[model samples]
Target: MARRNHTTELGSIACDDLTELGAGKEGWLVDNPNLLTALDTHSLAIANHSVVLVLDWSDGSDPTGPRVKIRPTLSPIESEYISSVEWLVFDDIRVLALGTSCGYLLIYSLRGDLIHKQIVNPGRILKLRVRGTKRDLTEDTSSAEICVVMPGVVARFDGSEIQSMLQRWFQETHSQFWDQKKNPVDSGSSNVRLPYQLWNVNKYGSCADAAITGIMPPPLMELQSSQRYYCAVTIGDDAVISAFRLAWWDFTLC
Candidate 1:
């Protein structure tokens, strides 16, 4: 982990403390009253963080601009390769969920201790979301509930059989991602637009070219007209912000 320290005397720092990093060190530190509660492949949903947060690159504007800092009092997650974090809608509150490269889906409390750790193997979860498919005009609309999209497949969790299905989907999916030529087939010329249309785990099958290629689908789809999704904001291993339209899944209404 990287380390740096700043000294404060009376809620303010001496100007001499500003060395190479910048004068706006204080500006980079914002407080979150609440943090995210859930994690999936695409993004983490946070609570008590802010009503509306802007994720633009700061160019390291220290004490003069807005930036955020993790709760100094809290310990970081034990795992190092956390790919993504998100908030899931639970009852009336948001919960933080973390996705790890070691195929772990960890649920944590606001204080950041692991509360639930489920092994979602094979594929590393890059995104997660709930689908409330709207009914077609020919079908009844009142009987619908939400379904979960893990990595390669989507399924309705009944508190029993869903986890098993999700595990199978995630593993096969990861295997497929790692084994590139087996899935993509034709490389750049291939027309296999992803996110596994209809959850077919092995459309191509396992092969020799398996690696962590960064090519994947868009993060979140259900836009809600007013929400924002954050992507990488920098070049070559940096964070960026991107936005998209959230389309309501239409075929699953039955």
Candidate 2:
């Protein structure tokens, strides 16, 4: 009931368990090749369009045990379907983020309450990828970034922006501890505008999916420019697989 990608180290539950998508349902699994879901040690949160469900693996660990379903909070009567989900666990913060068809990021608390929302793109979000890198002894490869991929665009959000905003959000409510049982009284004040980097990557045709794997060191013998360079890998029917060097000016690596 799992699918493994050796190249990206990405593993997904194929189908059969029930609380979420991986419960042996080939039809559902086959239809959702990208899979709108996020899996963590304690639970699996999966979405079908706008409907979201959280399945706790360790029943006793969470009081809302087994199953907790959530419908993203949108403007009254507004319809926005979820395209991707990502779980962020940093320090004492454990929250769920949903990427919507309207290119919005909706962050929710464990209790299934919306905490924050930010517009990321004008197009539907294809996927939300959360990555954290460790500092190597020889190089400064440490960085935490969320890769938000759209059809022909890719954006990145710094981990620090999210970390601080969540911290500030809880503080605004005068609560040092996160309470899963109730919604914060000051929830309205938590809408934060975070700065992000967006790049148009239409060089490889319209990409079905894409992510910035890492910040590469400058090419050998090349002067290190102020701009941080990244390698963008895109998947599409036209190219199957295409690689591009993303800098101030785009460079094709194919």
TM per candidate: 0.31, 0.75
In the range 105-185, model 1's lDDT, one tens digit per residue, is 554433332334554444544444443333355876522222233343222222222233334433554575455422221
lDDT of 2 by residue, 161-227 (tens): 8888888776754564455445533353344687787888886579999988877777878986777
Candidate 2, superposed: residue stretches over 4 Å from native: 1-35, 62-66, 74-79, 135-143, 174-190, 220-222, 248-254
lDDT of 2 at 70: 76
Q: What is the lDDT of residue 236 in candidate 2?
A: 77
What lDDT is obtained when candidate 1 is compared to the true structure? Answer: 0.32
Return the lDDT, model 1, position 33. 19
lDDT of 2: 0.72
**Residue 183 miss distance in model 2 (angstroms):** 4.3
Model 1 worst lDDT window (10 residues)? 228-237
Off by over 4 Å in 1: 1-80, 133-200, 204-254
